[model samples]
Target: MPALDKIRWENYARNLAKGMTQADAYEDAGFTRSKQAASALANNPVILQRVEELRTERERILSGPTVFDEDADTDNGEPLVEVTMEWVIERLAANVVSAQSTGNHSAANKALEMLGHHLGLSFSDKKAPSGDEGKPGSNLGSGNTFNILSLTEGLKQHAAALEQMPMKDVTPEDDG
Candidate 1:
């Protein structure tokens, strides 16, 4: 129950994120056998519950962030700090599609979860997106179907997932 240092990991965490297993991230982050000892804590219910509180605080700090808003004009436009589930998916899609080169949904979703962290959205990559999230003039693609995003992330995530998916599953279907 100790307090998190709030240590600014900066880009350090991102570097370790090049398609790492949750196990890898847990170790690389320097927790000492804690992920194993506190496996339940790994998916901490309390942490998830306080997400809204943390998010609001994060927004307050990032309100005037140094990163320039690409879709904004200096005087008229407001910074669109989009924190949508769909946007999170799109962001993670890069890795998802790459990992899914051989075709897999599970791998793509894992990629999405990791990438979602970077995008300030905590979501599972497995959960497919629904309607009404797409923006005006935006073609965010349909479902978890074979889209560029999922396809790409799948390629990266497949390094782990493929190892998990047994070779027997890849056999050509028997046509009876």
Candidate 2:
């Protein structure tokens, strides 16, 4: 019936914006206990407006910046800001330097070999994909009867259904 205090409403709005329940926000705002009172305060027009504003502000902050453009092949021939070849090389060099400083030749060599796969400087540790088609060794081995992604998804659903089925009950006479 009456408007909530400005400070309490603001506190309630902030908590509500963070996905807290209305009742929780009401109590957390430091208001006196009473479900009916809390409910009435939460439903007040001014409190509702504050909650909306806080929610909008939160949405804006979460969606702002820190987004990657996956469609673009490269950042105009420039190395990516994160995970660039130069970055990897720099890290490997740093590892070697750190190892050498501690008189750990093994560690230094290990760092060098870390990037060996990409640079072809050392033997690859990856298992070479066998030329077998539809076999266990390959991605879609002999067991995989269907190659279509949609069909594969259906097979997964079927497997899930099989797992959900109750086990068959057996009696001693039935077993015999």
Q: Pick the candidate with the highest TM-score.
A: 2
lDDT, candidate 1, equals 0.44
RMSD of each: 20.2, 21.6
Q: Give the distance in Å from residue 90's predicted Cα in candidate 2 to where it truly belongs.
A: 20
TM-scores of all models? 0.20, 0.35
Q: What local distance difference test score does each model get?
A: 0.44, 0.56
Candidate 2 yields a Cα-based lDDT of 0.56
**Candidate 1 global Cα RMSD:** 20.2
What is the per-residue lDDT of model 2 for residues 1-176, given as tens digits with 9 covering 90 to 100?
12235667777766776788777877898886667887787788777776776666556544643233243232121122335575566556555555766789999767755644344333333343665545453553333333234433533454465457443433236554
Give one clash count per candidate, in the order shown: 23, 4
